[model samples]
Target: MDTQTLIYIFVGGTFALYIGIALWSRAASTKEFYVAGGGVHPVVNGMATAADWMSAASFISMAGLIAFSGYDASVYLMGWTGGYVLLALLLAPYLRKFGQFTVPDFIGTRYYSKTARVVAVICLIFISFTYIAGQMRGVGIVFSRFLDVDITLGVIIGMGIVFIYAVLGGMKGITYTQVAQYCVLIFAYMVPAFFLSFMITGTPIPQIGLGSQVNDGSGMFVLQRLDAVLTDLGFQAYTSGSKSMIDVFCITLALMVGTAGLPHVIVRFFTVPKASDARKSAGWALVFIALLYTTAPAVGAFAMLNFVDDVNETQYSEVDDWFTKWEGYGLTAFQDKNGDGVMQYRPGDAFEGAPDYSGETGPSGERALANTPNPESENEVYVDKDIMVLANPEIANLPPWVIALMAAGGLAAALSTAAGLLLVISSSVSHDLLKSTFAPGISPKQELLAARLAATAAIIVAGYLGIYPPGWVAQVVAFAFGLAAASLFPAIFMGIFSKSMNKEGAIAGMVSGLVFTFVYIAYFKLVAPAANSADNWLLGISPEGIGVIGMVINFAIAIAVSRFTASPPVEIRRLVDSIRVPRGAGDAQGH
Candidate 1:
């Protein structure tokens, strides 16, 4: 069968399966809607958690970022994985012990204040919306390329699919569907890696292929060859870091803490039966997640090597169909800057901004650009970093079925996380803002209806953001992580570990951290794009890394303010002490 036929089969089959699961597992009550009745087995929950954690950012964008940025992008791998460890070991079990449906639920009860709950809901909504924007964009990218649909229409299609499963089944439906998505995404990710590895290095294992010498007569290792090729093109060496040490450290720390504070991931723990099960599920999730994370660096290196080898200095008329297809979507473009038919992929911007196509063709039959070419640069190609992974299979000339599977995997990664984020938004609005605070007298049925309505509204907003993304998939996601680290991580960490952290302190700290981080990011990214360089950044810390400073400020201010304020009530302090005590330990101590 043709590639498009295979894509339809794979994507349509998966969508059918997801919708089927939603129907089979539809929630009948508020408990089922919120926590899947809190009876999920550890292993099942682990697979679901793995799927929920590995969003489009992980499956599609992380490898792409690694491909373009080389060693500097290692921060994402370390920060995200390390953050998972912090969440599993430090936060998941305790939050599960607290037995709350959402993060806001925990904060409200733990702090003994409805105001604290509202503050947490605000933070959750901000982080979730920012994060979901990336997932929705991923969906659009996949559909635009594979299904031959406009990006806007693609986003609407994705929004419709998510609405069916998420609104109908809620957490119960999302959990089981994620388990299936985890299987599909992991299989799809590894298959292409195996093919490319063997084709390039005569090794089936991508991890081994990364270190192996090239299959060609050249004896250089993969990294060594990549460094040479990139430097020859006036780009930085692949093995070296261009970012300052402080920025790297700060970005890594922000991502780590941010993962721990993410409300969607935290709520996954609530679906399990008990605190111990939460820890077990976390361990299982790490094992499943490692399958993809370990393969990402190898995939990135291989994809970059293939792309440069195939496209650089190639004649524009003879370029492959994939390049033209992506160009039609306004993602990849080539310009005849030197009036030569040969394309040059070099360092520096190819155009003043993203290519503004003239809706006409050049003499060389390449897409005509309306944007001004960069005079200082000889580059003639514009490649979006988000396209590298999805285009990798095509660049390497892998099988058509493999390409189809990749399309399905990309959608799976994106939709799973989108569902999880939407659920968090819905739960926050219905459970935290309405049921717990404003409309405390509402019945269970009313709350369920409100939850579905909130999810519907959130999907529409998510679709809009997806259609008009602020940045690349991974960049947008990084901003979300930074915001979560600045606002919520400190509050949750202090609420669990410090008995004296009162509502006033937590709320004040969250507001301060969130505001500082948001302003710094906005100033650099939106207000002054020309001044986004390291020279103008505060302490040489980029907007991406400023969350570390905001987090520090949150901790310091919370501690200082708490010292001056009244301590928590005796009951709240005892509740904190009880959560810290292990389940069997209390019984043993009594004996």
Candidate 2:
């Protein structure tokens, strides 16, 4: 069968499976819709959480980021994975014991304030939307390249599939669907990694292959050879660090905290039956995630090496067939700057950024390309880093089935996270904003209808953002993490650890953190956008790292405000005391 037919079959099969599960496990009550009736098994919940946490950014765009950025990408690996540890140890068990339908549910009850709940819902919506937009873009990219559709059409189709399952099954439908997705995605990711590893290093294990000597006559290790290749080509060494340690520390810290604080992820623990289950589920979540995370760096390094060896040094006329194929998709670009057909894939510091369309002649009878038209880089061949994971199979000359599987994997990662995020957006609107606060007299059936409607509306918005994404899918998602770390992490952490924390303090701290981080990011990202590099930042913290500072500000403000306010009621203190232990916890009262 042709490659496109194979992709259609695999991708279509997964969709049918997801829809089948959604129909079979359709949510019957608000409790099932919101938290799967709080009856999910720990291991099952763990796999679901893995699907929830590793979005398009992780599966589709992340390895691409690593392929180009080299060691700088380690920040994402450490930050995202480490945050689960924080969740498992610092937050999950207590929150599970508290037994709430949503983060706002916990925040509202714990702080004894509707104000706190409202603030939290707003933050949750903002963060989820920011994060969801990236997933949508990722869906578009995969569909456009793999299925041969326009990106906008891809976004719409992805939205429809997510809507059918998410609005119908809610958390129950999504949880089981995600288990299937995790299987497809992880398999798709590893098959290529293992294939490429053995092809290059004679090892089936990617981690070992990454550190092993290449099968090529050279005795140097894979990473060592990569570093040598990059330096020789005028780029920084692949294994050496280019970013300041402070930036790495801050970015990693922000991602970790943001992962812990994200509403979609936190709500998964609420699905498990007990506090102990939540703890165990977090451990299992890490294990599933580690499978992909460890393989990613190897996939990235192998792809990079392939690009350097096969594409960079070869003349434009001699370029591989995949090069032209990707160019047809606009994922790769080339311009002969020096009047020589040999493409220069080195440091982009010497010429114009974009292709010059003007017929103006230069001294050497070559077309004179204007320098002002392009500013991103001067390199003659620019490959979109977003294409790395999806393109890896082709780069390594893998089978057509393997390439088709990569498409299915990218779709799985994108759709699974989109479903999870849309559910959070849906619940926040229907449960928190509408039913709980604005119309408390609503019936359970009415609330469920409202949730479905909210989900439908969110799907539309997410689809629109996906088509008209604000930035690179991964960078935009990273911004979401920074926002989450700044706005929600501090508030949630304080709500749990400090019984003395009052509504007034929580509100103040969240507002301060949210506004500061938003403004800082907006000023550089949209208002007066530029590189916004280390030299121009506050304390040398880039927009990516500013969330850590914002987190600090949130903590300081909350602590100061709480000291001057009245402490929690005696009853509230006892509730805190009860949550501190794991033995006496009971089944959560269903919504």
Maximum-lDDT candidate = 1
Clashing pairs in 2: none
Overall local distance difference test of candidate 1: 0.89
Per-residue lDDT of model 2, residues 154-184, tens digit only:
9999998998899999999999999999999
For 303-331, candidate 1 gives per-residue lDDT tens digits of: 99998888899998999988998888767
- The residue-level lDDT of candidate 2 at 42 comes to 94
Would you list the C-alpha lDDT of every candidate in the order shown?
0.89, 0.85
Error of 1 at 337 (Å): 1.0
Candidate 1, pairs of clashing residues: none
Model 2: lDDT of residue 499: 80
Q: TM-scores, in order shown?
A: 0.96, 0.94
Candidate 1: stretches off by over 4 Å: 355-370, 469-476
